[model samples]
Target: MKFDFCTLLASSLQICYDACCTFRIWNLQVSILIFFSLFLFF
Candidate 1:
């Protein structure tokens, strides 16, 4: 069965939200690595 436009939009929004969450976590991990690397250098 086919879905309506609203349902399609909701699915798209969910995908975008998931992608944003993933990116945020990735950014946090990278920052943590950089912080530790700086400490190691000093």
Candidate 2:
């Protein structure tokens, strides 16, 4: 039972970490797109 609980906790932590990484990448891509659009407009 303890082992299962540990595994569950580890998986949850991994998922949270992955989500944060994806969010950061998404934000970076959005910012880059906006910068390019502004540059083209001007």
Candidate 3:
């Protein structure tokens, strides 16, 4: 029972970590796009 709980916790943490990484990458892409658009406009 304890092992199962530990496994569940570990998996959940890993999922959260992956989501954070994906979000960071997406945010970076958006920032780069905006930067390039503004640079081009000027």
Candidate 4:
């Protein structure tokens, strides 16, 4: 039972880490898009 709980905790931590990385990448893409649009308009 303890081992299963530990495994579950480890998986949850991994998921949270992956989510944070994905968010960072998405934010970078959004900023790049905005910058390019502004440049094109100007």
Candidate 5:
């Protein structure tokens, strides 16, 4: 039972990390676009 719980928790953490990484990448891309557009406008 303990081993099963640990395995489940580990897998959940891996999934969460992946999701966070994807969100971060998306945010970075958006920020870069905004930066470039602002620079051009200014």
Candidate 6:
């Protein structure tokens, strides 16, 4: 029972970590695009 719980927790944590990394990369791309657009506008 304990081993199963640990496995579940680890998997969930890994999934969360992956999601965060993906989100961070997307956020960075969006920020860069916006920055360039504003820079060009001015």
TM agreement with the true structure for every prediction = 0.49, 0.46, 0.47, 0.46, 0.47, 0.47
The residue-by-residue lDDT of candidate 5 on 1-42, one tens digit each, is: 254645655755565566567786655555555556546644
Report the CA-based lDDT of candidate 4 relative to the real structure: 0.57
Kindly indicate the candidate among 3 and 4 with the higher TM-score.
Answer: 3
Q: Lowest lDDT 10-mer window, candidate 4?
A: 1-10
TM-score of 6: 0.47
Task: Pick out the ten consecutive residues of candidate 2 with the lowest summed lDDT.
Answer: 1-10
Single out the weakest 10-residue window by summed lDDT for candidate 3.
1-10
After superposing candidate 6 on the true structure, give the runs of residues whose Cα lies further than 4 Å from its correct spot: 1-3, 24-42
Best by lDDT: 1
Superior candidate under TM-score, 2 versus 5: 5
The segments of candidate 3 whose C-alpha lies over 4 angstroms from its true place after superposition are 1-3, 24-42
Candidate 1 Cα outliers beyond 4 Å, as residue runs: 24-42
lDDT per residue, candidate 6, 1-42, as tens digits? Answer: 254645655765565566567786655555555556546644
- Backbone collision tally, model 2: 0
Q: Count the backbone clashes (under 3 Å) in each candidate.
A: 0, 0, 0, 0, 0, 0
Residue-level lDDT of model 2, residues 1-42, one tens digit each, is 254645655755565566557786665555555556546644
Please give the range of 10 consecutive residues that has the lowest summed lDDT in model 6: 1-10
Kindly report which residue pairs in candidate 3 clash with one another.
none
Indicate the TM-score of model 2: 0.46
Instruction: For residues 1-42, write the lDDT of model 4, one tens digit per residue.
Output: 254645655754565566557786665555555556546644
Winning candidate number (TM-score): 1
True-structure lDDT of candidate 6? 0.58
Clashing pairs in 4: none
